[model samples]
Target: MQNHHMITPCLWFDDQAEAAAQFYTSVFRNSKILNISRYGEAGQEIHGKPAGTVMTVSFELNGQPFTALNGGPTFKFNEAISFQIFCDTQEEVDDYWQKLSAGGDETAQQCGWLKDQYGVSWQIIPRILIELLNHSDAATAQRVTTAMLQMKKIDIDELKQVAASQ
Candidate 1:
């Protein structure tokens, strides 16, 4: 069986790939562990495993498939790629921002971009970012951006204050 349009986001971990995958699947609703498979032979000692360690694990997050691979310490999650959460309200933003920022790094950018404890980046953006960017002028948008550059979690009121400034 296969879903033609299902494309899973693969994650790489030093040795905690399975643990992290389970954690994520547990945190999100409409989610569960789909499958877990160890390496065949190619990824044996290369991954500090017996050649059949956890080569890959498929999980679901909010019904989305995500694969985690224990590929050793060759690569680590950096700030390059980040997941953006489009939230409908400030409360939603606060909830996710707080949860993701637990033991994570807050970049204090114009929007909501932070690195979680596992070094995985997340953007707790409001769904209004697109609307705000569309409706406002560059000058006003610049002000909002300026305000946002000062803090994290993106307080809607604070962003409005910047947008309203002359």
Candidate 2:
């Protein structure tokens, strides 16, 4: 059980660390490149790769830390568990929705999940999800869950209204 906030997603790529880091930092506010390191001589012989190849690159997206590892094409990011971002308003959600889906695809899950060009999964959920989940009634949570299943990029106000109803 990994805590979402405490974790810094380490993404593996086929030599796209710099490019991917640049792209991601440009999209989100409060995002910046932390550091970048190339394969030193010690790393070259052990891994059997080139000496100057990119080893890792770190970046923060909206204060959340992430590391992009240039570890070749051995592994990939699947839709198993994704980073769920809490957006304050529809504009914030829409901005991320557009940028993230720029070279990616969109699904109809009420802004729950999307896969970026690097095959990274992200959940663009609204801030209301926390409120709904934190509600006193489990039934409300269930209702909100059911409603979320029918859409993508969740509408916060709609969920609030739904929770207020039967």
Candidate 3:
């Protein structure tokens, strides 16, 4: 086990901490559930969860440490925060897009962003996108950006084509 960073992103869930942790671990390589802390009688009145129920689940996704808390329905996930997965190839982008959006809200999907079944937002991006978007010529970058804006799951070939066209 490796020592993780002091600051880890904590995900708030409504009794789905364990399930979301399992799902995320299965999706990413080199990921696993590190620990689980259960609720206790000490804070039963305030938490309202069963004593043995999960309170927090510490996990890792692709070496990034994350904590999921079963904090009840007091809060909900929104687009304000999202996890971005950068892929080196189109295949990698497609694979991650398909897997992450499987049970997600299709309507919320645009420009490679989607809200998963757990309501967590994710962005599946290609590395080439950054290069294209940062090209020396502003026109080329603008073309790529325009193509991306019209897409749900980004198409690397389309971006390449737009960049190549006059």
Give the distance in Å from residue 103's predicted Cα in candidate 3 to where it truly belongs: 1.2
lDDT of 2: 0.79
The candidate maximizing lDDT is 3
For model 2, the superposed segments whose C-alpha errors exceed 4 Å read: 1-7, 40-48, 107-111
In angstroms, give how far residue 137 of model 2 lies from its true place. 3.9
> Clashing residue pairs, candidate 1?
44-51
Model 3 clash pairs are none
Q: What lDDT would each prediction earn against the true structure?
A: 0.75, 0.79, 0.92
lDDT of 3 by residue, 1-166 (tens): 5554977999999999999999999999999999999999897789999899999999999889999999999999999999999999899988888888888899999998998999999999998899999999999999999999999998989999998986
Q: Which tens-of-lDDT digit does each residue in 1-166 have in candidate 2?
A: 2325766778888889889999999998899998888887785655665878778888888878889988887887778867766788888888877888677755423446888877777788777787797788999998888888776767777888889999
TM-scores of the candidates are 0.84, 0.80, 0.97
Name the top TM-score candidate: 3
Q: What's the lDDT for candidate 1?
A: 0.75
As a whole number from 0 to 100, the lDDT of residue 115 in candidate 2 is 80
